[model samples]
Target: MTTTDTTATGLAHGWYALSLLHGRIEAHIERALQSGHDLSVREYSLLDVLSHQHNDEGGHLRMNQVADAVVLSQSATTRLVTRLEDRGLLSRYLCATDRRGIYTDVTDAGLALLAEARPTHDAALREALDRANEDPRLTPLVAAVEKLDGGPKAS
Candidate 1:
């Protein structure tokens, strides 16, 4: 299904079609992620952030930072983390200097989950990339997206 043919399908139109397409892809991947790794896609994304946090000292990242990275609200992120912690997938630590500040880190179990999920995740990503590459218009579309990314900062 092409995005340009907005009215071609009876059930889809323009942005609705785009959103539906996105939803379908996400649902497929989400189910696969949960069944294969015992982790949701959102959980995997959060774990990814934590794994990268090792360079930031304490092997942790602030909850807010993780929420932004995962595109989830603070409350939603908190709930997800709590669930993962209950499953022994991760741990949340309170910052010593600021009692109100919280950081999250991936536990050994979480790392294992990530390791198990990597292959499935990679395969899904590769499939999406292949689909994109098969479209002749993608080259110009990618060029437009790159241009819209803007150049270096103004000094």
Candidate 2:
């Protein structure tokens, strides 16, 4: 094979491995959160993100920012917010200064659920990574994920 072809194949393999790792981790977390807290991965992520907002200026995120953070489209984020709102897990309000802008926040119940589910989420992630590490093909990617925190050792 030509050098260019070899490089492309290598990139493809790397991309596939990364995607597989992400999918496995997310699925594991999803199952744990759902069984323990009745929350899907996206819902948990949204609640966690909104829980970090503060009362300071620009502390609250707009719909677009939330969408970007959650890696979903704006419309999808809105729908998710609505679903959570219906569950009393989130609430939405107009931006005080910008009538055209709106913000979403995690309700007290949402915060409580997130707190309860966090351990489950973390445990599931660690378990998934540990299992993945057993496969030599996935071990390097797992190590990279472990190094994401910039720590000397994988936690």
Candidate 3:
């Protein structure tokens, strides 16, 4: 029915607002990434995770760990990793210490791609926030989102 009518049902209003905000932001970011970098949101997310884990010696994470961090199913994560590996964005290697464990690490190409996509992602998020600010009803929801540490900031 009406917005007020929905809110009268209790805290469902806040949850609904958050879900709406999440969906809008996700769609905007997905579009921006796809058009600007030819990368899907999940692909970018996986690369982002690996990038953050990068270090002097080259950081890596187990497939299960990556799946958990990205909130994807194990099979889905494996497929995503395979795609990235095929694109030369990342590599999967058997762990020397534990043969059964495989580590996925970002390749130089992935880092460069991530560097390129960072601006687009940041701009999309900022635009979403700006649009949210335009709607008085979204003020609190936006504030809550702003407080969370989503990930690496765009430089």
How does each model score on lDDT? 0.73, 0.93, 0.87
The candidate that wins on lDDT is 2
Candidate 2, superposed: residue stretches over 4 Å from native: 150-155
Mark the regions of model 1 whose C-alpha exceeds 4 Å error after superposition: 1-21, 55-59, 129-155
Candidate 1 lDDT, 63-107, residue by residue in tens: 887889899999999999999899898898888778998888789
Least well predicted 10-residue stretch by lDDT in candidate 1:
137-146
lDDT by residue (1-155, candidate 3, tens digit) is 88887778657777788788888888999999999999989999999998878544536677888999998999999999999899999988887778997888889999999999999999998899878867777888888778885779989
Write out the backbone clash pairs for model 2. none
Model 1 scores a TM of: 0.69
**Clashes in model 1: which pairs?**
none
In model 1, what is the error at residue 3, expressed in angstroms?
20
Clashes of 1: 0
Best by TM-score: 2
Superposed Cα deviation of residue 26, candidate 1 (Å): 1.6
All candidates: TM-score? 0.69, 0.95, 0.84
Position 15, candidate 2: lDDT: 94
